[model samples]
Target: MTKEILYQKFGYVLDDSLINEIINVGVFKSFSKDDIIIDINQPMLYIPLLLKGHIKILREDNEGNELLIYFLEAGETCTMSLTCCMGKSKSKIRAVAEQDSDLIMIPVQKMKEWFHGNESWRNFIIESYQIRFDEMLDAIDSIAFLKMDERLYKYLVNKSMLNESATLLIKHQEIAEDLHTSRVVISRLLKQLENEKKITLGRNKIEVISN
Candidate 1:
């Protein structure tokens, strides 16, 4: 998309000069579905501005289990990664492409420079943090207040929404991995959901019929 379009989509206004500065400093990159954008414990090199498609921020345990923390869509920048970038610290989470995606990578130096030089850029960063912080809170609430079955159902609904379809072509093992549970547990919960007429399960796919 054009810079003007992206600015509009992201609800920001940038003059030609600032736009040119962004164009000059940002490197465009693409990733396929399931591609790892950021790995756990890796130092952040660049801040990503997602231009198209979707990504998932994942928190992984030392035992290699992963939990889906949040979703980053087009025009959203991941505040967690940006935090690591600013601090020059290693990442505590992983970022993965949930679908084919295009993004612009702003080098750490330029990210800092923009924050210092542009008031609008600083506001953008602050807003990004607030958004992600709220999402993290929601994640926490889900874990604290919701039962395992409820969480699984919510996760499937989220995936269905993201895919823009009621039918999701995914395996129970993958769902288990994302939810940080065992495959057998996920399978049992999925069967329960199916029996409740909330979803219809196939060999490797699930079709949401209700909540």
Candidate 2:
């Protein structure tokens, strides 16, 4: 694949030389929706810079239930993966393609190569850590303070935003899995949301009410 997408997606934040370094060393990869890009205990070999679509970051429990950490959109990289890469440790979370997507996978070594020489590269990494840190804090707050119904609503709204559509092509069981709950609870909550004029449900789909 041509590296033009990298220039287009990252041209604003990354300096030309830094972007070219990425182009020279980065491997372009694509993932279909729902593909497992990274799994718990997997070694982090490449740092992924999303070029298209969204990726969902998730944490799995000892029993395999999952809680969504956040979503990575185009122009974003997963900071958790960076941590794992830098430490030479296995991944602690899972990443799944939220939609058909493209990414540039830069080898782990280049992180140190460009960090000091390229101001833009350094800032990008630092800022990504800051951004993801805030998101993690928000995730913690949600778990600590929000009711299940409110959390479900927020999750639906987030999906709608990520897909850039009012309608989400999804299943209740999928939502339950991400929320680390049973499907029956998700179905009941979704119906309650619909009755409250928050959303409308259909077979394997959800339409979030905007007004």
Candidate 3:
């Protein structure tokens, strides 16, 4: 895709010359579904622009529980690269492709050059950070203020809106991790929701039946 298209999709624009320079320095890569795009504990060096497909950002706890931080669809860049370029010793999260994907890897040096030379690029970076920060805060608020059922309800509602099919393709374990609750608790709450005619559970999907 052209830089203009990418900018329009992301709701931010970059100078044409700078965008061209970045494209020249970046490499296009394809990954299969479930492929690890960024590994944890590694030194991140490239900013990956997801051109196609969906990805999940996750981190594992000491007990080996994987916690989902966020999900990124096409047009989002990996945040790990920004953290690394800012002098982080190791990446704290892992990025995995949820489906067959295409990505553009921009070298850290190229990003620094753009940041130094293009005010628009710098503003875009700051805006991206602010957005991510707000998301983190919202996640924290959900964990602290919401009950498991409420969290699950909101998650289902969001997924329903996104897919237009009431069913959510996420696994129960993943939902538990996202809500910082146990699998048993999530299962019980899901059953309760179903009993209340709020949702329906299939093999691996939960369909929201009520708002």
The candidate scoring highest on lDDT is 2
Alpha carbon lDDT of residue 37, candidate 2?
94
Clashes found in each candidate (C-alpha, N, C closer than 3 A) = 0, 0, 0
Ranked candidates, highest lDDT first:
2, 1, 3
Candidate 1 residues lying further than 4 Å off, grouped into runs, are 1-5, 11-16
C-alpha RMSD by candidate, in order: 1.8, 1.1, 2.4
43-141 in candidate 2: lDDT tens per residue? Answer: 888989999999999998888789999999999999999999989999999999998999989898898777778888889899999999999998899
TM-score of 2: 0.97
Error of 1 at 24 (Å): 1.3
| lDDT, each prediction | 0.87, 0.91, 0.76
* Model 1 RMSD vs true structure: 1.8
Ranking by TM-score: 2, 1, 3
Error of 1 at 204 (Å): 1.8
Which pairs of residues collide in candidate 1?
none
Prediction 1 TM-score vs. true: 0.92
Per-model TM against the reference: 0.92, 0.97, 0.86
Question: Which residue pairs in candidate 2 have backbone atoms (N, alpha carbon, C) closer than 3 angstroms, thus clashing?
Answer: none
Q: Ten residues in a row with the worst lDDT in model 3? A: 4-13
